[model samples]
Target: MSKPFSQACENNKQPILDKLLVHFRQASRVLEIGSGTGQHAVFFAKNLPHLQWHCSDMPANHAGINQWLADYPSANLHAPVPFTIGQDSWPLELVVDKVDAVFSANTTHIMQRSEVPIMFDLIQKNLPEGGIFCQYGPFNVNGDYTSDSNRDFNQYLISQGCGGLWDIADLQVLVSGLDLLHQYALPANNKLLIWQKC
Candidate 1:
């Protein structure tokens, strides 16, 4: 089987890593919720050797993720972890022993609106006090789109029957248990939001 690839992942990995380095500088372990293609796993683990990067997703993506992990072979990077979303028990399954941070990119807007709250709930339950959750994706503020591209993207997502451009404020309301730390605007009109378990 050939390695799966995502051009967007390739483009965003470095910038994401730069932000992660600052926020998770002291973190020893991070659980990446949707490790699509394992590109971020390889790149981040190579760059931030101090933290253990655990890559996980639904079983279907495991093969591709494992292929990348096998090729990279970082002692600190663990990939091919299988997980189910919105199961309530799902996050606990992935949590296993210890996790200092949780990261998921480009997942929230693709999931159903109902599932977004569930994901937040699970992250809240799994992360210890003060643990950070880094979520990167396009988001709205007060029901307003930040860019024309994001507006179009939201429409496209709606056409596909998926939730799109979740409101950053709405997310804060959903995960009220978590404190919003930082919100960084990225190159592609996307945003990286950091929230800490309070």
Candidate 2:
């Protein structure tokens, strides 16, 4: 099968890696939720060889993700484990023994609002204390859009029946056990929010 591709993933991988190099430097095992097409998994695993990158997503996405992994074939990057945030058990415990960091990109705003909190709850339950969680996406600050493009994107998401841009303050409430560490304004009007498990 051919590899599935995401242009957004290709554009954002490098900048995301620069930050991961710092926040996840001490991490040995990283769990990437919603691995999507697996482009980021391969790119990040190739660049950050020290950390074992485990990709997980719903079963439907696995084939495309695996195809991407097979082409790049990083020793540190593993295949996607079937994970349905609120339904499935944490894949880390089933696949690897543990994970010290968690990463997700462009997932939150597309997920149903109910699933967003569930994802965080699972991260809180499974992520070890002091573990870092990196969430990259467009988000509102204090319930206000940062740019017109993001406002439009939110409308598009809502039209698609997905949850729209979540306010940072609202996310903070959902992420109860994790402390917000850094919020980086990335290119394309997106933001990368880092949190540490308390």
Candidate 3:
């Protein structure tokens, strides 16, 4: 059976890719968090041949990600890895030094606000000096929702027992002590927070 496609993923991949190409030109060993369905992993690894892509997500999503990899296996694309953002012990057995960059898409809005700091701390611990962490999702700014669509989406997320949209300021404050630089605004009202470890 053919793998299912997510319309949102399809619509946003190219735009995300364009931004990645600009920042990831020299990056190697990219760790992708919340690699749902593995479409972005497959596409990015194929396009950015120089970077070794490590796709990861909750254990349940790893099987589907692995299946997606079967169709487009490449030297730079590692097998799907199991990772939970707030877990004390990561499931991966390898003891790598540090990743050059980390990328996550459409995940923050679904995770609790309190968990955000923990996730950032984990990313900081795993990233080497000058490493970049890129997160893509909808965000509120200055305590106000950016769009009506985002407001509705936030409500729906809460209804589904997930965390709603986060404010840019709130996230910035959470990462304030970390060695990070922020980049905001992205296509489709979604924001891309790029942090370069100092």
Candidate 4:
């Protein structure tokens, strides 16, 4: 592909940046997980001059991300680092420097349910106290889907090998070390959840 594209990323990048601009203003380094297509990394890095943006994904997605980076090369934007949550020393091996913020968009429900906590474990190990982690996706509240669309989406995804939508309550229990700081309701019934390491 000349340059991978994501309509979802195109639609939501600005809104995500609106929050991260203020939220991560002080953050010097940001590690983006599941950087599908590397679209968000390029957009965010270009807009947010203060942060050094690091894009990461599985080896399968490296070329797409690298293509994006090469096309819109930024001094603060780094290339992809092999990342598979739960693998031993994967983060340390790929990420050479310390990171204060972790960002991932629309990835939780697409990954295996059992893999979610492992992802959190890796973030917890790397993100220091007071570090921020922002996740953008559709999620549930009180064990209930927020809308019929989300319910149908969850069912459709579960029918495949992908995980279903997650609930805030369950996530709080799963990653108790991180304190819920703010929850922003985004368009299309999606959400942007910000957590700070405790």
lDDT of 3: 0.81
- Provide the lDDT at 194 for model 4: 96
Point out the worst 10-residue segment of candidate 2 by lDDT: 88-97
- Taken over the whole model, the C-alpha lDDT of each candidate is 0.86, 0.91, 0.81, 0.89
lDDT of 4 at 177: 79
lDDT of 4 by residue, 1-198 (tens): 567789989999999999999889888999989999999999999999988999888888999999999889999999888887756454674356899999999989999988899988888778889999999999999989999999999999999979889998899999967889999999889999999999
Of 1 and 2, the candidate ahead on TM-score is 2
**Total clashing pairs for each candidate:** 0, 0, 0, 0
Model 2 agreement with the true structure over 1-198: per-residue lDDT tens digits: 667889999899999999999999999999999999999999999999999999999999999999998889988888898998768878745345788899999899988888999999888888889999999999999879999999999999999999889999999987889999999999998999999999
| Candidate 2 local distance difference test against the native | 0.91
lDDT leader: 2
Stretches of model 1 off by over 4 angstroms after superposition: 91-96
Measure candidate 1: CA RMSD: 1.5
Model 1 lDDT at residue 131: 91
What TM-score quantifies how close candidate 1 is to the native fold? 0.94
What is residue 133's positional error in candidate 2, in angstroms?
0.3
lDDT of 1 by residue, 1-198 (tens): 888999998889989999999989978888988888898889989999999888888888999999998888999998656766775365454557688799999999888888888888887877889899999989998889999989999999999998877888888877867899899998798899999999
Among all windows of 10 consecutive residues in model 1, the one with the lowest summed lDDT is 87-96
Q: Which model is ahead, 1 or 4, in terms of lDDT? A: 4
